[model samples]
Target: MTGPATDVWTVMSTARTIRRFTDKPVDEATLGRCLRAATWAPSGANAQEWRFVVLRSPESRAVVAKAAEQALRVIEPVYGMTRPDDHDDSRRARTNRATYELHDRAGEFTSVLFTQKRFPTASELLLGGSIFPAMQNFLLAARAQGLGACMTSWASYGGEPLLREAVGVPDDWMLAGHVVVGWPQGNHGPVRRRPLADVTYLDRWEEQAGPTLVTEAPPS
Candidate 1:
């Protein structure tokens, strides 16, 4: 962790959402390191309820891909229902294209699904509050090591039964989502964001006088 402040900034800025990836496999040692980092994430009452199911084998990955595809089919129509009437047709076309590409790429990526044991609403929020930060830490650490990843929840739609069966998860477990990791196939660059003034409010919850950058600089 010892480094110049600028080095930290560099790492943060370089972390981006990577969808495409190389075919090379992530080794055991690296995977272990990432999992170990996840263990340090904070939890409610120290009730660290997070569980990870890593799908590494080709067979297992295929199972996940099939389940995810089934889930996406049920979800796509629902998504179409939520769009505005004025939305561009080209945008929808592009989205549909990306959906297929993501599906095809999914089987080759390293997938890890997260879960938590059933709990009351408050406890569930606390568990999520604890787990998500750890998940971010894991993603950032992967980025620092030149790996790329994206978090996706599309698999949670109607795929829960299949996931539970495939992963042998207990009846009381709740599925949070999945994260895919690999060496990115494309470039990483600065992301587009809105100016800060639009979203931020001053002491009285009103807009401030200065121009604001909408997106915070990517986490370092």
Candidate 2:
């Protein structure tokens, strides 16, 4: 709510992954508001045993930055991330550039660590059923507040020990996600996505939800 109030549909439709950010820092009030939004998300069995840790101080962010660097080593190779030049105008190249830039500047952004209480019988994916919705709420709230955010895997990659030690996470808490938030240096989205007709199904898995779209419709 730090920014002007936006309609729900507009907010949902425009929300997209934002990796590039400005030098401006997100204030405490705005961050708290987004965290409040996260609390509104539903969890399996209504356990609501989620916690969020914020790293904003220089010392803490330095730790996050170190973790981000470690994560990039794993990310870059596996994803075949390449450095893009001024001449490179392709979509993939641009995306890669943004990814790298975010890692390089991670220390400057405010990072949030989301955690859920560990349950004896639950798998990680199953545990995510309780936490991912809260995380989504966090993302949407950030987008609504005119803040740019990107969820990172720094804590899940080779960074678990580093971040856990830096944040002093309890043994019972599992790190669900890491997200960086800041004022965007780039533009917001009219996000690109596949048409609904391409993804939806009707009453059954085998049924098409919309008219069939054949590429190059046979000579009319």
Per-residue lDDT over 90-208 for candidate 2, one digit per residue giving the tens place of the 0 to 100 score: 99989998999999999989989999999988887889889999998998898888888899999988899998898889998899998999988776676687866667778788567
TM-score for candidate 2: 0.90
Clashing residue pairs in candidate 2 (N, C-alpha, C atoms within 3 angstroms): none
lDDT of 1 by residue, 8-37 (tens): 465566677676677888887777666777
Regions more than 4 Å wrong, model 2:
1-5, 211-220
* Count of residue pairs whose backbone atoms collide, per candidate: 9, 0
Q: Model 2, residue 49: displacement in angstroms?
A: 0.6
Alpha-carbon RMSD, candidate 1: 5.6
Against the reference, the lDDT scores of all candidates come to 0.69, 0.86
The prediction achieving the highest lDDT against the true structure is 2
